[model samples]
Target chain A: MSQVEELKSELTEKLGSDIQIKTEFGDDVLEISKDKVFEATEHFKSTGRYDFLMDVCSVDRQEREKRFDVVYHFYSSKDNRRLRMKAQLGENEKIKSITPIWKGANWFEREAYDMMGIQFEGHPYLKRLLTHHEFVGHPLRKDYDSNRQQHCSKAADLHFEDDETYVPDPNKDLIPLNIGPSHPATHGTLRIMAQLDGETIHRSNVELGFLHRCFEKMAETHEYNQIIPYTDRLNYCSAPMNNVGFCKTVERMLGVEIPPKAQAIRIILCELSRVIDHIVCIGANAVDLGALTSFFYLFNMRERVYSLFEKLCGARLTVSMTRVGGMANNPPEGWFDDVLETVATLRKGVDEIDRMLTNNKIWIERTKGVGGISSEEAIAFGFTGPCLRATGVNLDLRKANPYYGYDQLDFDVPYGTSGDVYDRYLVRIEEMKQSLKIVEQVAKNVPGGDFSIRDKDIVLPEKKDVYGNIEGLMNHFMLVIKGLQPPVGDIYDATEAANGELGFYLVSDGSKRPYRLKVRPPCFAIYQSFTQLINGGLLSDVISILGSLNVIAGELDR
Target chain B: MSTVPTVTRDLHAESEDLLTTAAYTTRFDKLVAWGRKNSLWPLPYGTACCGIELMSVMGPKYDLARFGAEVVRFSPRQSDLLVVAGTITEKMAPVLVHIYEQMLEPKYVLSMGACASSGGFYRAYHVLQGIDKVIPVDVYVPGCPPTPEAVLDGVMLLQKMIESNQPRPWKDNWKGPTQ
Candidate 1:
């Protein structure tokens, strides 16, 4: 039986007549009544079809009749399918939590509680996950005004609760180690309170919002073309991929067919970015392993990649280059030649890095068996990318879904048998080589054309042409200021990011700005499984696992 | 211009007589020069992807070792140059300010990216817009990363700025501009 269908059938058998099952794009969706959600979740898990509670997040349905709908995304590792169980829980109502079934759902559920104001009943510890403990209101709700500066009552009092005078556990003597609002290793402004049992971590909780740029809200406020710049901040490592992800999501929502040349260019750029992301991961892992020399070696390779990025786009990091249809600017003269040269240079460096660490005794000893996780545990905790591949799960969305002519490209899906840190490292290295292969294929197969979809409705006419023609001028004006509007629809499109399945769920309400924009960031899924991976491991192993995961705070908290 | 006991020799003889000028004034000038030269351990505070490029600045090709800045300390106490190498968000502002405050006197900062210098195009409510608001910037190395060459230039510029100082006057004249 196919994974999707099997999950649906199993869900139907479990829920019986109480739930309404719907399949959206091969995902088995179960719309359980608000009252029966907890019961249904329990039954679904008992059925063994959806053993893992992948993620529990709530979406604000302010415009719709259903005020607030909570989405509980489930995955069956055995079947390799996903099942989403959503409930139309009324505004300000308490719903039963599924934290009992899966311990991993603790953080996800708490995040929903903290952000969406959805109270998860029966949660062991329902404290705010991302936002401060004294934060005034739910920030993620559509109606919530993010502009309000006085969200927290006081700097000391960062979170709030229904209890008038709430006091945390006094007996749990956990020394406060303020990781960062600016400290290194936390990456960005992420501060985690690690309740440690000496060197071992009893429990750790993340305190995000230090770098919360309100990107989604801004994207909603800005025009379509204006929002592309914002995507650059989400996955700062691979700005091109984020741009492509956003554009592709909007394109899917609008049902616009981009030119073959544009598609080909995007694939090439995205794959290059994937390679860069892996290089960073590998370099960072090497740094954590005390192999500081390898960092410089890999950076030498990255310098060449940056040159290509500069040649292709004006900016290096904030590459707001890829537009909705074509590109913001044309490639510089001999850009392809420069790209080919860069690849050649970087390829040699990659080989050297591989030689330095591939069989090195110290590197293997540090990473070989450290932070080993099984495929089942990984899937249960919703791990993806090289992290998932390390566990021998052949699930790269690029191959499975084949967006942007990915199916046409001849590349290998590199998987490692051992789900250890070493395997993850090996997978990322191999993935980089495969990315090179894809880049080479794309360079060879790149079609020549206008580089954009020649359409007045979708893509703005040239500035000169627009000035010459009245209609073109009007269209350009509209596109520049108000942005292009797509019909009302919702679509979820995922690409194989270096980290994992980087999915962007975009909803257009026949307006220039997206009505709803939810980034299914790969880092969040991988980072959630962090505590699980690091539970019994040594203190130093935390650094190892974090590096291996490549959990960028920018993408995670976004 | 009358023979006034030749003030230089008179002062020297008088000082020499008075316990040999009470020893040395810690050789203030040389001490300052030595302190400045030996301990330039920088806090390479990087955020976003530009941080990766910032890391490249300390790497082999453009080794920061020549300037005695190879030891990129993560802590503020031991660091001299705080290289803000990405967008500074409002959420990160206070922390940046705190880190700047924690560093000992005679410190420098390098806003090492378009985002860190001028907010790039990520001008949003959460982003501080620029690092200038949070800390006094010594050099603004402009690029998405300000290439290793640009970083070296900024470092050299900062060193020159530090070197051209006339001690007391430099200390007194240092108004510490907001930028």
Candidate 2:
């Protein structure tokens, strides 16, 4: 039987005849009772339906009797099914941690504890992961003060009380290595404290928030269109994906359909972003592996992409051009022709790089079997994007759940079986080629229409209209001052980002800004599985696995 | 009769030197100019997205080698110019200062982008605000991400700045538009 059906049958049997159990909004979710949650998860894992514990984040429902709801997203690699298990937990109640089933859940559970104040009773190590050793009050709770800076700083005061249960490391042989807040290979500002037994990682604890800007809080204050600029900073390498993801989520919430031309433009920009993102990863990875020459060759191509970006948007990295309903500006005339030229140049450049590294003895040796993880393990650990693709999962959200007209396009979902650093590299390289193909198709199929949605409530009026007409001026002023107010509801929309499934879950309470904005960053999921990839491997292998995963700190910490 | 070609070559070289001397200055000055022009390995203090574009400058496309500024040594110890690309944060100030201090004498700084030039829109509490506060700048390439062509132009400007120092007639001419 299929995983979803089997899950449904099991859930129905548990809930009984009166209680309703149904999948909502076509997402891979199965609603279950708060009491039977632990039992269901254990059954789900043993059934071999879902092995990976993708994310376990919570949302606050102030009005409900149970003020907090923990959302657990699980994935079954064998069936290619995603099961979201949500259980409403009262503020006083605690859930049993699933760390026993999946080792990767250790950090995720701690993060939930740190962010949402949700305690996991049986968690192995439930200490603060992102915040300091002595933090209090979850920052993500609904009633948590938005203006209170004390919550962030005061959280450091809560001490990790050591009693009889917490015995110090009995064997003091392992050396402690702090990877960085300043180290070169940590990517951004992530400091990984690892206990090592002579070049082999005994246990790795990832410390985040050194670079955290409180993006969710910032998004709450900013208007919908204004939020686009901030998204660029989140995953700066793949800026367009952030733009498209934010726009798509807002579009879904507003129930507005964009012009075909705008969709095509979004596709082209997203593909360009994907290509450049891979270029950055490949170049940085090559440099980390001691091949500095390839770094220059690859980054040179990324510069050309940057030029194209400049021509399209006034700003390059922070190209905050998307409106709630559609694009802020249409592509200039002859834009497609220029994109074609750049694509040709990039294709040749990519080939040159492939020639340099495809058979290079050092590269192959360093990356081939290094940081290898099986498909089952990857899925169990909630690996996504090229990292998941490396494990032979033909599950690109662009293909499996086709958003932004991806269903209409014909392209291959390239995958790998080995799930090693080398396989991840191959998957990204092939994915870039596929993205190029998609861009070509988009350029060919772009149609002519209004770029922005005509709905005045969601989008600002045209510049000409605002300048000439009083009514238009007032509308523009309102939009600039107070953002669009969507209906009071929650919407979660995702896109296949260059990294993985970059999902945005926005909760609206009839306000100009989001009541609660949660970004399901794929990097965070991939980062949770880092210790797994590096445990038995060499110290140098950490660089390879970290690069292969392409863990951008902005996305991970945010 | 045996050294006729050598004598002519000497005469040709002497006459060319005389012409160059009449038009300009001493041979010692000319040698200094030559030394400065041939070796300008720019140490790029690239921080943000513009750093990507700066990489392109060294890439095969623009090939900064055509103008003798190709060797981009990351170490400030071995380099001449600090190409400060992207936004420099306040926290990065000490490190950038240390790098600038490490660079050899007669170094130049190229603040590449709006953020580095002035503080782009990220003019918040933490940004270094402007690179000029930390180090003396030679040329500022103004753009959110200045195009590779603009970067090349900045390199040429640096060369001109160096060339004008050699006691030349053009140095007395109008100093070009303030970039």
Model 2: DockQ against the native?
0.09
- Candidate 2 chain A minimal-lDDT segment of 10 residues: A151-160
Task: Give me the candidate number with maximum DockQ.
Answer: 1
Q: Taking the tens digit of each residue's C-alpha lDDT, what string does model 1 give over A26-145?
A: 456777788878777777666675665656677788877777878777655454566677789777688888777776677778778877788889998787655544457776677666
Q: Can you give the TM-score per candidate against the true fold? A: 0.85, 0.78
Q: Count the backbone clashes (under 3 Å) in each candidate.
A: 8, 7
Candidate 2 lDDT over B28-117, as tens digits, reads: 655566568667888766656676667677777788899888876766778898888766554445456666778887777888998788
Model 2, A1-558: lDDT tens digits are 964566577766865543344554445655566776777777777876676666677777889998887877776545546666778889899888888887667767887888788889888778766544434566666666544432221111211223213224646646767665444566535556666788887666566664444567667666677788778877878888898998888778777788877788888889989999999898889888899898878877777776777788766566776767888888778889889888988888888888898889999999998888888787776778899899887778888777779899989989999999999898888888888888888887688888877777888899899999999999989876777888776666778899998988777888887877778888887887777678767888888888888877657765
Please give the lDDT score at residue A63 for candidate 2: 93
Off by over 4 Å in 2: A1-9, A15-33, A48-52, A62-66, A74-84, A132-137, A141-176, A194-205, B1-179
TM-score of chain B of each: 0.74, 0.78
lDDT (CA) per prediction: 0.73, 0.74
